[model samples]
Target: MHDITHRNRAESPSSKTLFKATAIALVVGAGLLVTTVLPAEYGIDPTGVGGYLGLTQLNAIAPQETAEPVEDPMISDAQLASLLNPVWKSSAPLRNDTLTITLGPNEGAEIKAQMQEGDRFMFKWEAQGPVNFDMHGERPNAGDEFTSYWTGRNKTNANGAFQAPFEGVHGWYWHNGGAQPVTVTVTTTGFYEKLYKL
Candidate 1:
């Protein structure tokens, strides 16, 4: 029987060095992953209850304030009539619908006169003194008779002409400024001639 002596080979120097380097790298990598990478990707909240941070809520906005405007009161029938056909006549009887206006020294005012019932009229003006006249409505056609006789020198003369622009009962209001009392007679001659012959 022959006895054989076999020697166990020692581990190579490069292999021992490689094993130590791999163990050190793995330890350092695990420490970095726990300290930095995990928290940033999936956030770690100290409260342990998870929720979105830096987000806006729908309830944060306040409700808008709204307002409504006020309206004017409706006028009465008598008041409306008075405004539409205003007259200041201090009478001496007989009115086929009479309206009078007394003008004080250099006083100027507008009296809105309307003939709501009739649609075509010949308006006549009889006054005494200096009067500035401007008429509005369907101006009367040519040769349409509308007589105006005043107490002054310009009375009988057809000093002015107003053609009715629209078909409607129309009348005139005048302002007289003279040293004496002036009487004005206004008359409507056409369209159900409700003689406003004041």
Candidate 2:
């Protein structure tokens, strides 16, 4: 039988040597703290080397991220509101329509514009005499199912804007309520496909 002995011959480091190595490491850590960590994380570039190396930019960016941007005073309130609260955009072109309708006593008529969902329109109408009116919308092919926006009795005029909640025909139904006939003229400008008597 043969016996083999293997052992590590290197001596354990001396306390003096270990202390010297620890001091060297401490010096390097302090150097890095002054040159990099202080400027990059806290904007403290006492040695100016961190600023020269562009490490201060990191701390500069932190404040900018926490700060709210200053809004320009030249912007109008409406412009600012539009920026903060965006509006719907449609592919439809801008158009205008002026419709003059005459209704005999106790008679009714409708004038509407075909609008897709999110379309907007402005309308103004005046009647020679007071008439009852209803502003409503109808979805395509949805017979008898409609959304009424406004209604009034014996109104001589009306003016307002509308945003379509769904794809539909939207407009006014005015009924002559007086003993005599009434003539109503309606003007509309907006992003609608067509306007016609229905």
Candidate 3:
């Protein structure tokens, strides 16, 4: 009976040791599998957070501006004159068809004969004399003799003629109903006398 009891105790200890070794091996293998697979799928890691899933934090980029094309304005005196009127031929006696200067009193400038969208003309007076005129409801002041003139919206002694920026309608009326006969000269071409674009 004593020998049998001793043998039973030895066998019991061996069985318990084998069971513990098997349990420890299974736990270690499961931990290795979770560490390798869980980080790639759930973005979770034992050591780091974002680096586990290969993600990085960066700043947002802004959009850039695009380049566009521009078109130039059409400039042609003959074309402008034709746009104003085709049949209104320039008088051979008058040197300039853009404007006709009448040096006598109570005489109006015959601009209606050759007025056009691009027809820019000027009426410069040799002497400042009393002149009356109307343009788009804005008439020239009385007793103001102008030296050098343009048929544009703004008037000054800068240039001798009006400049047509583009194809647009414009008009001017003048009367030399003063005491002396006014001698006015005019010149017109395809040159733009003012800066319209900035």
Candidate 4:
């Protein structure tokens, strides 16, 4: 038979000690929330420590500039019609052309269509291997000046439509960069006068 009343009971921490521990925990949690969580999450730097640590920039918004609007000059209907008309009128019938050319390693070639401003055509081309290409145009008397519409590198195929911006030659230039030969085949249809190799 054991004397149960004489046994020692488990002791609890003093009220003062418990209160001190809880206060310390609350202080540490509040400090962490103010210094780290606020600045990093919301860009709110209250104590300046977040700014010193560069955490305030995490949510910073960039400054933006306001652009001034410009007004366009209106043109008369007759002027607009004159500007939209084609430079040359062809009495001959339209034609379609397909061209295939082989380019040696590091070699280049070009093909042009005789087109007037507002003339349009659909074109598609493919290379047997990867190549670089540029679609551009030039006026006959413009003295070496040219306008580039698009350019691409390391491509195998492309298809698109184009409307001439001036009375000129519009076309594509392809450059083969591989060690082996590459063949480029192009098919076009529309109002162009002719397709010729350049």
> What would the per-residue lDDT of candidate 1 be over residues 25-124, giving only the tens digit for each residue?
9998975554444444445433322323311222234568766644756788898988888653322222234345655655533332333332343455
Worst lDDT run of 10 residues, candidate 2, spans: 1-10
Which candidate number maximizes TM-score?
2
Please state the error at residue 15 of candidate 1 in Å.
99
C-alpha root-mean-square deviation, each candidate: 28.4, 19.7, 25.2, 10.9
Winner on lDDT between 3 and 4 is: 4
Q: Estimate TM-scores for all models.
A: 0.29, 0.58, 0.26, 0.55
lDDT against true structure, model 3? 0.44
In candidate 4, what are the lDDT values of residues 44-96, reduced to their tens digit?
Answer: 88998888888888878665777765475678788888998846565534778
The stretch of ten residues in a row with the least summed lDDT in candidate 3 is 189-198
Q: Count the clashes in each prediction.
A: 11, 0, 1, 0
TM-score of 3: 0.26
List of clashing residue pairs for candidate 4: none
Residue 111 in model 2: lDDT: 95
Off by over 4 Å in 1: 1-97, 109-118, 138-170, 179-181, 192-198
Error of 2 at 189 (Å): 0.7
The number of clashing residue pairs in model 1 is: 11
lDDT (Cα atoms) of all candidates against the true structure: 0.44, 0.91, 0.44, 0.89
Output candidate 2 Cα RMSD. 19.7
lDDT of 2 at 156: 97
Candidate ranking under TM-score, highest first, comes to 2, 4, 1, 3
